[model samples]
Target chain A: MIGRLNHVGIATPSIEGAIAVYRDLLGATVIREPFDLPAQGVRVCFIDTPNSQIELIEPLGEASPVHAFLKKFPQGGQHHVCFEVPDIHAAAADMAAKGATVLGQPRIGAHGTPVIFVHPKSMGGVLVELMETPKGDHH
Target chain B: MIGRLNHVGIATPSIEGAIAVYRDLLGATVIREPFDLPAQGVRVCFIDTPNSQIELIEPLGEASPVHAFLKKFPQGGQHHVCFEVPDIHAAAADMAAKGATVLGQPRIGAHGTPVIFVHPKSMGGVLVELMETPKGDHH
Candidate 1:
């Protein structure tokens, strides 16, 4: 079962520009500096809220999927929503059994935890990511 | 200041179909039954997660904005992300001073609270809603 809404990923043309919107405009005070996730092919920044986070992501490589997404939505937009599940493998099996198309096998996600994506077609057109809750994180 | 992420709005063609995806497919147990928010021109259903809610919305009438969105995507998709604000009035002024366009004046949202939307163009193409945190409903 899904435990919590982990984070909402917002693809951005420039992480610095997005940071300004959240910090200066939205009055967000807990933004973390942008960091590169080489394996994920994206630059990441976190805007922490009281109960969740807004992840600002920018394409980092020639073949990064975010680049393709940016081509479709040139200005960048909400990319996907992630939910923490009890177990990634079991969640994949459950999704398959319930008729949703699992995009691929569980792999390390931006959070450094096993994660799998469900195709947007089978999910009402909203791309969804299922992540294995971090070992020590019960929430 | 923005508080919690109140909900992520997903525009769906069918509320019943979206309900099944969250309940049967995603193993969500706390799904709320669909209800009409005629003033907002949509039928709404809430999928409760520990940290936030996933709001499934379907166009309710001919003039609903969701109809325009559905015409574009057809299969439905993420529409907007809503964050709770301590004061909607002040938030609007803050956004104006910082160069983001407030879509319109704050009005009654689906949750029966004052809410305003920021133009997607000004926020990295992410449509954002800022709602006044309901009295005594602090997250």
Candidate 2:
């Protein structure tokens, strides 16, 4: 059901510092400017790769999950791996039926596409994000 | 210069248990049989997706890096994200020149491709793996 590896989310204490690694070191030329998503409680930016993207996420508030991750690791780390699914609703349903814990209802993700998170416990302790590929961008 | 996301490595205590989740829960039909990579000090298997894969890694011995990860988290978690680079040597040199710690030297990775790892400290604490794509598989 997974289409492509959409983006790998990295929880960072400082997005600017992480951006430097991708920009100055990796020579990534198409990094989108970072933006805050209050609803998601994080600030995010996309570092485009040849086939996918690296998502840098920083906590926007104390209540943010990224905040807790930062508190635990201080330096931050890989937070989640997102994969594109052709249909979010069906993916979630399939996961639920097969005993995977779907976090919540499908909601608009950072890419403006419906997405749902699978509980880490059910996915070998790696948080898995299932996103419906935006129309016309399907692979 | 990343080519594509080859795989997201997930450290797991039990490969069998993780395989069930990918097979029964996600309905992945192209799961590769688990194999032990004694050189890498881990047992691994590829769960193929449309565009990439989920590499399930389990510690093979006390010296395994996955052993350390499991000790810290117990439940296991995302180990590292591997991105394909057209030239692993150049990628390592480029990262080193930019002050990123390229761990050790490029060695044969699970996919039989030359791969190098970047230290997490220089990458916002997210361990990044850069691998040269196998010939004839360029994207």
Candidate 3:
């Protein structure tokens, strides 16, 4: 159902600090400037790699979904893994049929793509996000 | 200096159960048979996706590296992200020079490729593994 590893989301207390590691340390050339997604309640940025990208997410407010995660982890950690799917609707249905919990209806994700999150409890504790690949991109 | 995402390491208490999710739920066709690596103190299997892979790892003994992780998490979780690099030695030196703690010298990893791990503390709490790509495969 999944196509490719779109990006790996990493929760962090500070996006700037995370950027430094990927930019200065890892020598990543394509580090997008950080931006806020108030609706999602998180500040995000992408660091491009040879194959995929790393998404750094910081809690934007108390209501941020990542807030509780950061509270328990404090130091922050791997938040989730997003996989590209050819069809979000079909993927969601397939996963649901296989006894996975679709957290919510498909919503516009950070990539401006339709995405749905599967409850981590049903994914062996690994939070999983299935995203619809943008039109024209062949995986 | 990362080449491509070779695999995502998921620490699970039961590799068999994990395989079902990837194989049956996700419709993964290439699910490698589980094998024990006593030296690494773990049993491992690989589920290949279109772009990368999911490595299901289960602690083999009390001394397994993932033993403590499972004890703390209980439900199992994403343990680390492994990236392919062109040269393992150079990657290690570069990371070390940037203040990232290289866990130990490069050693043969699950894919029979040389690999080194960077401490989670230095990587925004995300344990990172750098593996040298197998000869002849371009990242």
Candidate 4:
């Protein structure tokens, strides 16, 4: 079962600028600095909201999925809503069973958690992400 | 000071359908049903997340600002992030003092709370909202 919302991902052209705006303008504290995830072709920084988090994502390469999202929707806005789950693989399977398109097999996300993306078509055009906490075996 | 993320507002084409999707598909419970806010030009339903809430907004009139936002950005998606504050007026004043554009004077919001919206331009194109629990006098 999907749990609480972990974070809202914001796709930006420049992570540095987005960070400054979130921190200075919105008074949000930076929970993590920019970190690269080569497999995902992006770098991420996390800003803490009182109850959740705001993930800032910047494409590391032209081939990145985030890069394509930006190219298609250049509004510099919300990218996805990630929900915490106990088992990403199970959640993805369940969603697929319910006629939702699973983006891919569960993989390690930037925070070392297993995660998968659900296509927006199943969610009324809002991209939904499911993430699982790292298990002892995976870590 | 902002305490935590209060909720994320999603502008949807259909409030009932959206509520059903969140409840049936995501296993979320409806904390509140559709409530009309004529002053805000919208009707909203609240679904509880583990830590926060997802507010589905359905605009009541074509002249509503949310309608304009939908017209400009046709994709039904996350609309704004609201932070819980101790004092809405003070927070709005502070934001305005920091060169951010305050959308309006703090007004009574849903659940009898005082709320104000910060302009998207001030927050890197992401709309930010500040909300305060109403004091006894205001309530």
Against the native complex, each candidate's DockQ, computed on alpha carbons, is: 0.87, 0.71, 0.74, 0.55
Tens-digit per-residue lDDT, A1-139, candidate 4: 6577788888888888888777776666646878999899999998886567889898989999889988865657788888888888788878887788889899998668889998876775678988895565231
Ranking by DockQ: 1, 3, 2, 4
Clashing pairs in 3: none
lDDT by residue (A19-96, candidate 1, tens digit) is 988887788899987889887799999899988899999999878889999999999999999999989999999999
Each prediction's Cα lDDT score?
0.91, 0.88, 0.89, 0.79
Global lDDT for candidate 2? 0.88
- True lDDT of residue A90, candidate 3: 94
Select the stronger candidate by TM-score from 1 and 2: 1
Instruction: Give the CA lDDT, 0 to 100, for residue A139 in model 3.
Output: 41
Q: Write the per-residue lDDT of candidate 2 for residues B1-139, one digit (tens) a residue.
A: 7667788899999999998877777677888989998988999999887778889999999999999999987878999988887899999999998888999999999999899999888877888899899999744
What TM-score quantifies how close candidate 3 is to the native fold?
A: 0.96
Candidate order by TM-score, decreasing, is: 1, 3, 2, 4
- What are the per-residue Cα lDDT tens digits for candidate 2 across A1-139? 6767888999998899889877887667888989998988999999887677889999998999899989998988999989888899999999998888899899999999999999998888889999999999845
Best by DockQ: 1
Can you rank all candidates by lDDT, best first? 1, 3, 2, 4
Candidate 2 RMSD to the real structure: 1.6
Where is model 2 more than 4 Å wrong at Cα?
none
Runs in model 1 with CA error above 4 Å?
none
lDDT of 1 by residue, B43-114 (tens): 999999988999999999879989999999898999999999989999999888888999889999878899
Which model is ahead, 1 or 4, in terms of TM-score? 1
